[model samples]
Target: MTVGASVKQTLANLKGAQGTLRTYSIKVQDESARSIYAEALMTTNKVIDDLNKRLKTIELEEPQYRAY
Candidate 1:
C-alpha cells in the first residue's frame, strides 16, 4: 500500500487500541491495572494526535492523498 494508506491504517489501529484500553480501564477491578491502562491510553492518545497532525500535513503536501 501507499505511505498515506499505511499511515491511515496505523492510525485506525491505534484508535481501536485506544478504545480497548478505555474499556479495560473502566472494567478492571484492580486499581493498579486500571492505572496502568489509563497511562497507556493517555500515551496512545498523544501519539494519535501527533499522527493526525502529520496526516494533515501529508494531505496538504500531497493533494492526491486527500481523498484516501
Candidate 2:
C-alpha cells in the first residue's frame, strides 16, 4: 500500500519476469540461434536492471510521507 513497498514489489516482479524469460530463451535457443537469443536476453536483462536501479534511486531520494 505504501510507496516504498510498491516500488519493492515492482522490482521483485521485474526480476521474476526476467528470470522466466531467460530460462525460456535458453531452452529455445538452438546452436545456430544461440547468438541472437543471447543478444536479446542481454538487452532485456540490462533494461530490467536499469529499471530496478531507478526504482531504488527513487525510493531513496524521495522522502516518505505519512499515509492518510
Candidate 3:
C-alpha cells in the first residue's frame, strides 16, 4: 500500500487501541491499574493527534497522496 494509506491505517489502529484502553480503564477496579491505563490512553491520544497533523502536512505537500 501507499505511504498515505499506511499512515491512515496506523491511525485507525491507534484509535482502536485508545478505545480499548478507555474501556479497560473504566472496567478495572484497582486504582493504580486504572491510572496507568488512563495515562496510556492519554499518551495514545497525543500520538493520534500528532499523526493527524503529520498526515495533513503530507496531504498538503503531496495532494495526489491524500488518503483521508
For each candidate in the order shown, give its overall lDDT on alpha carbons.
0.92, 0.69, 0.91
| Runs off by more than 4 Å, candidate 1 | none
lDDT (Cα, 0-100) at 7 in candidate 1: 92
Better of 2 and 3 by lDDT: 3
Best by lDDT: 1
lDDT, candidate 1, residue 13? 98
lDDT of 1 at 8: 95
Q: Give a tens-digit lDDT track for model 2, residues 18-62.
A: 677677667874766666667777876787788767766766677
lDDT per residue as tens, model 1, 6-48: 8999999999989999999999999999999999999999999
lDDT of 3: 0.91
Stretch of 10 with least lDDT, candidate 1: 59-68
In model 1, how large is the Cα lDDT of residue 57? 87
Q: Could you tell me the lDDT of residue 52 within candidate 1?
A: 96
lDDT at position 21, candidate 2? 62
Give the alpha carbon lDDT tens digit for every residue of 1-68 in model 3. 87778888999999998999999999999999999999999899899999999888888888987754
Candidate 2: regions farther than 4 A off: 29-40, 62-68
Worst 10 residues of 2 by lDDT: 59-68
Q: Check candidate 1 and list the clashing pairs.
A: none
Select the stronger candidate by TM-score from 1 and 2: 1
Clash-forming residue pairs, model 2? none
